[model samples]
Every structure is written in C-alpha cells, then in structure tokens.
Target: MGTDKPLIGFIGTGVMGKSMAQNLMDSGYSIAVFTRTKDKAQELLDKGAVWKESVAELANSADIIITIVGYPTDVESVYFNEGGIIENARQGTYVIDMTTSKPKLAVEIFEKAKARGISALDAPVSGGDIGAKSGKLAIMVGGEQQAFHEVKPIFNVLGENIILQGDAGAGQHTKLANQITIATNMIGVCEAIAYARKTGLNPSRVLDSITTGAAGSFSLSKLAPRMLEGDFAPGFYVKHFIKDMTIALESAEEMGLSTPGLSLSLELYQELAEKGEEDSGTQALIKLFD
Candidate 1:
C-alpha cells in the first residue's frame, strides 16, 4: 500500500510454510510468526523473524497475515475461534489462507472478513516442498481483485505462476482441480514404476524414457525416483493428499460431476493411511503396489 514493505504475520511454520516465510524475509519484508510448535518456529526466529505467542497477537501486529495450516478444521480454529485472526486482526489488515481447504470455508471467511473491513483470499498453492524452498509454487488465488493486487508482491516472492481465478472460494476450487489431476497422475506414476520392476526393466531407465513423452507429469518426473530409492520422506504428506482428494471428491459430487480416478486414488491412499503411512510422502503410494 506504500513504498515501505508491509509487516507480514505468518502462521504455520511446518514444511512449506517455513520456506515460504523465509523467502518473504529474504525479500526484505519484516515477519512475525506463530505456530503450535515453538520448535518449528526456531529457524525463522533465528533469522530475526519475531515470534508471537498467539495467532491473535500475530494478527494484531501485522499488516498482512498469511496462513498455511492443516485441515479445514484447523483453518476454522485459526480464523473463527475466539482470540483468533479475525477477532484480533486490525481493520483493513489482509488475511490470506494458502492451505488447500474447503471452498465453502473460504467463502465464509471472506464474508466475515468483509463485515469487519478486512480482506481475505483463498490462495492455495501447488509444487510441494521443493517449490516452496525454490519459490516456484503455482498459486491459485480467489478473492477480491484489489486484495489480490495488494498481495501480488508477496505472492511473487513465493511462487512463479500466480493467478486470480475469481471471487471468494474460486482459488480453492482451482486447487481441487489441481489435486484431482495429481491424484490420478500419482497412481499412474506408481503403477508404471511397479510394472517396470515386475518386468525386470530398470525403473530409472523407464522413467528417463517416459518422462519426456506424453506419459510425463510432475509426479512421474519428481516422485517416481523417490519411490525407486525407498526415500519416502514427505515432499507432501500422504494424509494431506488424502484430505485434498476427499475435498475434491465431495466438491465434484456436489457439482453433479463424477471423478472415478480421484475416487480410486483416494481409496488407495486411504489404505496407506490405515497402514500408518500417513506421515510419508505421496510418493509412498508405490508401496501399495508392492
């Protein structure tokens, strides 16, 4: 809104959030952060990002607030609860939720924020942890255009492709479209690698061949290798992917659309969650084929 950089309050310091916040700091924005686990906030704190004891404290002190927490329930708690972001944030402060959450929740937040003279955007992201660390995520934004324009500089620091999809909740709708595609593509990536191993072909060699062809995708290019190496560490967690797929399926059904591939992927991932692989990466879906 001015020549001086806006003070940013960042909530959620885990995995991707940590890197996204660091990038903003690197871009010369002052940051105040709050997270459930104090330990996770340490790296940003060490880098001179001030730590707030509560979400309200962070919201009150910051000119712009960005959150990328887990689950729709968590989103509600952070924004709607007493002593939460909406209750404590100053008038005219901008709130952005980058979490892949329910589109309905995003609209509800927009309505509430509007009543309070605040601007809210549902700006979910893709490209996983690597994207966050490298600042190349694809951000799909939904909210007022002016609000998005105000925050475009902040988004530029965190992503490569930033788009304003439409009014409140549209960004999350776009993200669900993204998750649906990734859901089915992940299954293809896993099964192809599993099939290669079964046929005594080199999976890596197969990857090199197919990754350049029509069979190529982000998961095939990035995660298929992790599956081969037994490196299941999370670039994006299995549980979170399940949450996203569930949201996608529900949204599709409500729109009278059928998403068989998404449903199948959700079924397989649910099996992984049942086996306690929820903390592992989405790449771990290959384990189901094994």
Candidate 2:
C-alpha cells in the first residue's frame, strides 16, 4: 500500500460502524474489515473494503485498527484474546477502541499497547445512527497527545465535533457523562409526549412549541418524531443503551454520586427490555407510556 494514507482495519460494521467505515473509505482510506456476522459486512466488502478472515489478520494487514464492537466483554475478547489485535499487529500500529466500555478496561488496553510499543486510544462516540450516516458524530478521545494528533484526520472524516479528553480512560468516562444526561432527557421527552396525548392535544404541534424552547434537546428533536411515527428501528439499540446506563450507574456509585433521574430511566428501560424490546431503538422507551 502507498504511504499517502494509512491502511485502516475496521472491526464491527453494525449500525454506526458501517457508516463510520464508509466515511473513512469515502475519504480515500484503504480499509480491511472483519465482523463475526459476515453478511453484515457484505456492503463494505462490495465497496472495495477487503474482508479479513479474522481480527488478527486485519491487524497484521493494516496500520491503524479501529474497533466499535458490542458490550465491554466483546471489546475485551477482540483485544486480549491470543490471536487478537495487540499480539498480531506490527510494532507502531495505532489501535483505537471506540466502544463505550469500562474506563478501567480502556486503561488496561492502553498499558498493554504501550508495552508493545504501539499507540492506543479510547475514543467513544455519540450522535447515534443519523449522525454516523451524516458524518456528524461527536468523538471524545483519550490517549497520548501525539497519538490523538496522528488520528485526528481519520476522526475528521467521521465526525464534526472531536476532542481529546485526556489520557488512558478519559474518553469512556466522558461517554458515561454523556449517557447520564441522555438518560434523564429521554425520560422527559417520553413524559412530555405521553402527557400531550393524554390531554387530547396534538403531540406534533406540542413538539413544535417546546422543541424550539428550553424543553428542546437532541433526544426531543431527533427521536420524538420517531416515537410519533411508531418507527422503532434501531438508530441506537435499546440493549446497548441499557449497557451504557448500567456502566454509568456503576461509575456514579463508585464516585459516591447520586443520580435518581438516571436510575429511574434505567428502571424504565429495563422494564422495556424485559418485555423483549431489547432489539428496538432507544426511542422505544416511549412505548412503555403508549
């Protein structure tokens, strides 16, 4: 491969990752991709992204590896397994984990990468599937300054707002904060719409009235319509949001912080998940009220 651009190895081409990898490919990066579900990667493979047989093969072939898999356990398996990225990647490769995982795990990955003379960054992103498709994600990164700088170009192709939070696990901590805020805001959005419907008011007009005022939020603006239209597709999965909220609650407890609103939101979402709405979008939280 030419030195004009780094070869990118992309793991997990699910809802957001598919669009993110597509943005990188559109920006002229050569990509190698791997995912457990081969059919999910068929689109990227057809778009000139070489399909690697495994994560290690992708690691060996690419100069920069980025992973955005499910759950913290999935993140651990991809990086710490015997045939994982750290062991198979060449020296000096940059490894970036964009999964919203535990901060301690991010630190562990960073330390292991440092021991092998590789650079690692925990770069968790927000803005959901629409943002990913539009290349307008907000990427919060944590790692060495130089490594952050080296990867900024790749991030620029994938997001509109990108910032390096601090070293090691800072990005995951930042993401938890983001998720906490969203948790409460989502409850408010659902309650407002539910109240509007119960009072015989037009929910759409009510949304227009408050959405431009202090009541407006990313959740209210983007997801409220989906709730109204009954489009419960997974822009961001309910199960994944539950995972994020669980992490946030644990972190908050560790810090001796109280988050009653976040706790309530988590409870409501857990009820939804228990009803088999786990595969639905986060907006499906409104379904409980409906």
Candidate 3:
C-alpha cells in the first residue's frame, strides 16, 4: 500500500476480475485481494497484491473496496454477512459491486452503506474479458453523483466508456438492459452462422461481410470467430448468462413487462445448460442450432 494512492481491496479474481485487477495494478495502484479460492488469485498475488484470508480482513485495512463476485447471493453474503464489508470496512470507504446482480439488492447495499457512513455504488459492467483486459469496458454506475465523480478516476483506469446512469440501483437496471440485448443478439449470431454453413458459404467470409453491416454486434464480431474454430472456452460463461437472463426475466415480470424475445432466449439457454453446456462460453450457443 502507498501513502498517496488509496489501498484498493479487490474480492473475486475470476475471468474478468483478474484482468481488471491486473490493469489497476499495472497502472500502479496498491491492491489487496481476497477470494474464496486462493489459487484463483495466486497470479495477482505473485504480481504483488497483498492477500487477505477473508473479506473482513481486507475490508478493515483497505481504503477502497471493489467486488466482482459470482451472483446476487454472493454479493449479499459479502456485503451483509457478519464478517462482511459493512461490518468491517472503515468509515468513508467506497465499496463498488461490479457484479451483474438484482437492482433491488444494489439499492439495499447503497442505503445500508450510506447509513453507516460508507459510500457504495452498483457499477455493473459490459464488454466481457476482452474489454476487461484492454480496459475498454463500458461501465454503468449507480450511486450519488458526488461518489460517481469521486470514483471517476478509478473507473477511467478500468474502462473507456463509463456513465453515471442514475442513483442507487440504476446501474444494475441498465446492466439488466445490457444483458437483455446480448441474450437476443447471441441467438441471432448463432442462427446466422448456422444459415451460412447450411448454404455452403465460408462462415469467415460471411462474417466479414455481415459483421460490419446492419447485422453487426459484439457476439457476431467477436464470439462468432471462436465458434467457427470450435472454441467453446468461456470468456463469459453460459451459466453466468443464464443467471443474468433469469434475473432480467424476473425483473421484467415484476414490472408486468412483456419480453417475448428475452423469455425465448432464456428458455434456449436453459436447455443448453441442461445439456451440460453451462460452463461453456456464450459463443457455444452456436451448438444449439446444430
């Protein structure tokens, strides 16, 4: 930890979290990391991040805390648990949860943190692993305008496209909207490639033509190539996508919104998960068409 730069405590060094934490470390921030699986965080540890055995220890010592854990339940456990962030984090510490979680949970965290004199933000992100490694992620933040501005420098280090969406849970709502877009776009990308293969068009060349056209999308431009090469390794896991879509669907139902496309996408992904493809990448949706 440095005297000038705030001591940043990062919990969860999974696929995207590791890269995001590394980018911050490479940019010269002193980081303290805590993860359930220490082996998952060893790379960052070797790169000089201080390791804390638990979130409580990390929370007590660090000036700022950032988490990108697995799910909404994990988010709740980390922040509201007996030995969690709220209980141990120092006054005025800024805690940011980058997990794509329920909007209401984000709001609950914000209100609780505010009462305790801790600053909290729900700043869920998009752009996946590539964006995390390149620091080009699109970050949507929800919190007080003042806290958002205060954290802008940190956000700038992790992402190029950053926005203060609104207050408390607004960032999460915006991220849910993002997940909805990706869910349907992924299905379209898979169907287009399947069509291309059936017609004997070289999928790569087809991509070159269509990916820059009106049909272009992140899934089409990025994941389609991986699919073509039969690479189903996870950049963003299908299981996580299922979680995001489930949350989005539940949120929609709560508001009495009709989301036929989202509903259908959810069903297909759930089916894929049942086929034991849940751990595979979102690009693996192409397998469903076959």
Which of the predicted structures, 1 or 3, would earn the higher lDDT when compared with the native? 1
* Candidate 3 stretches greater than 4 Å from native: 1-3
The alpha-carbon deviation from the true structure for residue 77 of candidate 2, after best TM-score superposition, in angstroms, is 0.4
State every prediction's TM-score relative to the real structure.
0.99, 0.98, 0.98
* Index of the highest-TM-score prediction: 1
Worst 10 residues of 1 by lDDT: 186-195
CA shift of 236, model 3, Å: 0.3
**Candidate order (lDDT):** 1, 2, 3
RMSD to the true structure for each prediction, in A, is 0.7, 1.2, 1.4
Colliding residue pairs in candidate 2: none
lDDT of 2 by residue, 182-276 (tens): 99999989999999999999999999999999988899999999999999999999999999999999999999999999999999999999999
lDDT of 1 by residue, 226-272 (tens): 89999999999999999999999999999999899999999999999
Clashes of each: 0, 0, 0
- Model 1 residue runs over 4 Å out of place are none
lDDT of each: 0.95, 0.95, 0.94
